[model samples]
Target: MATLEIKDLHVSVVSEDAPKEILKGVDLTIKAGETHAIMGPNGSGKSTLSYAIAGHPKYTITSGTVTLDGEDVLEMSVDERARAGLFLAMQYPVEVPGVSMSNFLRTAATAVRGEAPNLRHWVKEVKGAMADLDIDPAFAERSVNEGFSGGEKKRHEILQLGLLQPKIAILDETDSGLDVDALRVVSEGVNRYKASGEVGVMLITHYTRILKYIQPDFVHVFANGRIVESGGRELADVLESEGYVKYTGSKEAAALS
Candidate 1:
């Protein structure tokens, strides 16, 4: 139903001193009901793409355009992007020390939906979502991601994904630092969201382990600030068997090859 189009996007950031470009004329498109996985090496600009799309101030788009359903995305503020149906599951979810989970969720849903969710129904929804995510009832009383473990933080991110139900979900390293059990649980939550057939997913990850749980319709290989290759699920399997040596000529990968 919705289409996210990226046309020749170029992004830059301040690294210590001068401005350094991270994304180089990146062009991609994702429609509702499609899942795209972006895989790449450490410094290959994977996170940069997500941040730029999410309208983070750190990454500046010096060229090109991003549109959601043919509407300009770059012109909107970060919060406006969310209301425009964009969701980003960050690699490192920050801690909001004073905000309780329930209030935070309610406030966010209120803003994104343009009106406050009814108290009674919202409570039921939050409880149901938490139960499905295996979160304790008492957990909602705690501050958001405050002192939570790495796996807990990741689960919390997936929890938001299930609740907010954005059009385009950009998950950056959702599998990082998760145990086998945690990975499966989070992946299932993502699967449930994608199953709706109305959400376009842009999942960015380094390993293929999560792919086994959440299948991607398309896999894109990012290298040196650009997409080097794009293919089907078989591309990820290929990467698992043969590392990124083909796209990246790093000594570490060559030794493995």
Candidate 2:
């Protein structure tokens, strides 16, 4: 089991003159076997925080540090970070033409596990994971995420999670585009990944619907790039009832009320 720690972390997107600030001095801690949910209005830098932690090249860390299990993650390259037991499920999964799902999963697993997985065992694992998600084994022959629906992409991300078995999983908006059934399947995948008791999950989402399937250990409200409030799973229910209106302080929300 490992813990992900971020301290006074700041992030900015590159530009000509100066970097545009996105994450403004955010701090968070996630322990193994625990699920932390980050909820916020759009453009509140919730996704930026995940990308920065995963070391996305486009987001520069202006200051502070991110550590995993007491190791300095800020110093490691993205691939190194993955090998060090970190996985980020992207909001927009990219299609890599010509890369079969099996090939991609094998290559990524080899990279993340730092060794080639046992072929027989690996194949069985893949089949079981797909079965659990109700995905056809035939889908493995298709190119990675090519022509995949929104829900399929989300399920594929969870498939990677099951295969990789990272110590910490950061799911960035995995529920964003999923329909009801897909959302349930994806959430189930997440639950299965947690069954090992060796993995921790940090989930980011605007909607509280997914929370019904994947109960959170903690729920945080992010505003202006920082977490303004945090509580137990019930906070998710509050967000669903009232929306982000209280957190965002938007005039439109006030007017609607």
Candidate 3:
């Protein structure tokens, strides 16, 4: 089974004066078929953890190791990470002004799969996935995220997840901007992927609303750049009711003990 292991991860973002450490000695492990939800207040380095695992250049790993099934993920390039079965669905998906959804999906699938899919079957697969997500067939002709609503963009992210089918999928706030209906649709898409029993999901978010739909197997409370508390789905309930009052300030103090 595939396992993503992170040990003492420290990440920094270059600021105006110096590199600001965002993640401090964060350690996490995700296994196949497991869904881990990382919840924390804003600026607590939740997104930073996702980006660091995806090996975003902007965030430097100052210490610790990240490995996927024993292979050093920190040494791999961004595209390499994808090929090695890691995927990141950004909080804000970017726009590709001229790339059609059909073309983009096909190209991405080709790269990840190491060969172009059979044209006849590929079209059917795309059509089925889009329909399942309640995405209109017309979207196939539209440019990726170009002039689309936020909910539409998030749906498109799940569209990619369905097509790519990575071993570990890191979704950074996939629920943001979605209404009740859209959230349900997108959560279903994710649940579909999880049903495969071979994909692990790391869903990072601030609110527990999405949790009602996604139902993470494990809930991690991230604060001060580390996971301070972890438990079953009940942890989310506690956070919703109690808030992060215990972990809001003094990140250093919170993580140390």
Best by lDDT: 3
lDDT of each: 0.91, 0.90, 0.92
Question: Model 2: clashing residue pairs?
Answer: none
**Per-candidate TM vs. native?**
0.96, 0.95, 0.96
Error of 3 at 108 (Å): 0.4
Question: lDDT tens string, model 2, 183-248?
Answer: 988998999899966788999999998888998999999987788899999888888899887877
In candidate 3, which residue ranges exceed 4 Å CA deviation? 249-257
lDDT tens digits, residues 1-257, model 3? 89999999989899878888888899899999899999998888999899888888888889999999999999999999999999999998999999998999999999999999999999999999999999999999999899999999999999999999999999999998889999999999999999966889999999999998887999999988889999999999999999987787565454433
**Predictions: Cα RMSD each:** 2.7, 2.9, 2.4
Cα lDDT, model 1, residue 120: 92
Model 1 segments more than 4 A misplaced: 250-257
User: Which window of 10 residues has the lowest lDDT sum in candidate 2?
Assistant: 248-257
Query: What local lDDT score does residue 249 receive in model 2, on the 0 to 100 scale?
Result: 76
* TM-score comparison, 2 vs 3, better candidate: 3
Candidate 1 lDDT tens digits, 123-233: 999898888788888879899999999998898999999888899999999999999999999999999999866989999999999999999999999888888899999
Error of 1 at 227 (Å): 0.7
